[model samples]
Target: MEDDALILDLQPLPDGIDERLAAQLTFIAEADRLKTVLRASPLAAADRRENDAEHSWHLALMVVLLAEYADAPIDVGHAVKLVVVHDLVEVYAGDSPVYDPQAVLDQQAREEAAADRLFSLLPADQAREIRELWDEFEAGATPEARFGKGIDRLQPMLLNWLAGGGTWSMPGATEARVRAREAGVVAASAALGDAAGLMVDEGVRRGWIRTSEG
Candidate 1:
């Protein structure tokens, strides 16, 4: 009995748990569950439509390549991470049109609710980290957030241009409207503005956006 007790005591226990990692994994798993509803915007390429996930991925790519254009110096990694998580609320809020003043008005409320519900599902610490990042992006108060916003506006402008001004040709879309939508990039980074200018030029050349109607 004494020998048996000593042997049992000598056996090692499993390692202590990493609650942080567990929470992170939980969030990552649930992240795929987000749904992105379209707002009458068509895709640039295939007949198939773009979803929120695709949009997030595209923006992440842009974040990497466009870091040099940020209005202020920023952590490119954080900027990319911000973009990856930004529209994740859209998975819940659905894609509200930038041109729809009413929809835009309601977007903040919807997205905040979605963030609460979605982030709460993760482990507590991970939830806090992710939610903080999401909040920073919404606030647009930091350099990373600004750059993220820039990419966010730039992507759709490019997509619409490629789609032959799918939204631009819609009843109320005008150059002024498009510029307003694209101008958020300036707040985030000047490079984003440069990119938007290039996109606007392309839109004009492709006849997707009107040029001289000012």
Candidate 2:
């Protein structure tokens, strides 16, 4: 956690800033803290966990590269925007691990409050636009949002595979839990879903993930 002194003693914005620009800059400065919000997923090549900013950036890139795999036609630009802004609320709510049953109990309420507080830092128009995107992504009601959700679930699985089962090796990580968590990936894109299944199967075969019977 950042010390209160460092967070409270922020430098003031320079003089003569236009109202709109000041709001925009203020939101941007607040976004900087997202980099400090660490997630449970670790780097593929290292022991350290990936931060929320890195996770969001990687999701945006995934949308760019895998947009073609979406089950239905989608606006790639909108999908990219969805991924980029999806986790901004984590700056306030903090990243909750998917495997942590207790942490997920009130996840929606916590994130919604964070979204309201963080996005409200921007101009009204900008805040509404961002909040809509965030909500859409959360709802997963549209083709683009479904695709975005697919990659969001898929990325950590891929990372755990590449990192030699970093999280999968933890106690209580069973094949059933992994499959249940990633069912959305399969629903959105069969190809990517197959790939994710292959990773999990390999993980189990190699003893990276434990089976229920084990």
Highest lDDT model number: 2
- For candidate 1, write residues 76-105 as lDDT tens digits: 889888988887766556777776667778
Task: Give the per-residue lDDT digits (tens) of candidate 2, residues 64-182.
Answer: 99988888888999999999999999888888888777878899999999898889989999999999999999999999999999999999998998898877866657888888867
RMSD to the native, candidate 2? Answer: 2.2
| Alpha-carbon deviation at 130 in model 2, angstroms | 0.2
lDDT value, residue 94 of candidate 2: 88
Candidate-wise lDDT, in order: 0.74, 0.87
Quality of model 1 by C-alpha lDDT: 0.74
User: What lDDT score goes with residue 20 in model 1?
Assistant: 67
- Candidate 1 residue pairs in clash (backbone atoms < 3 Å): 71-189, 146-188
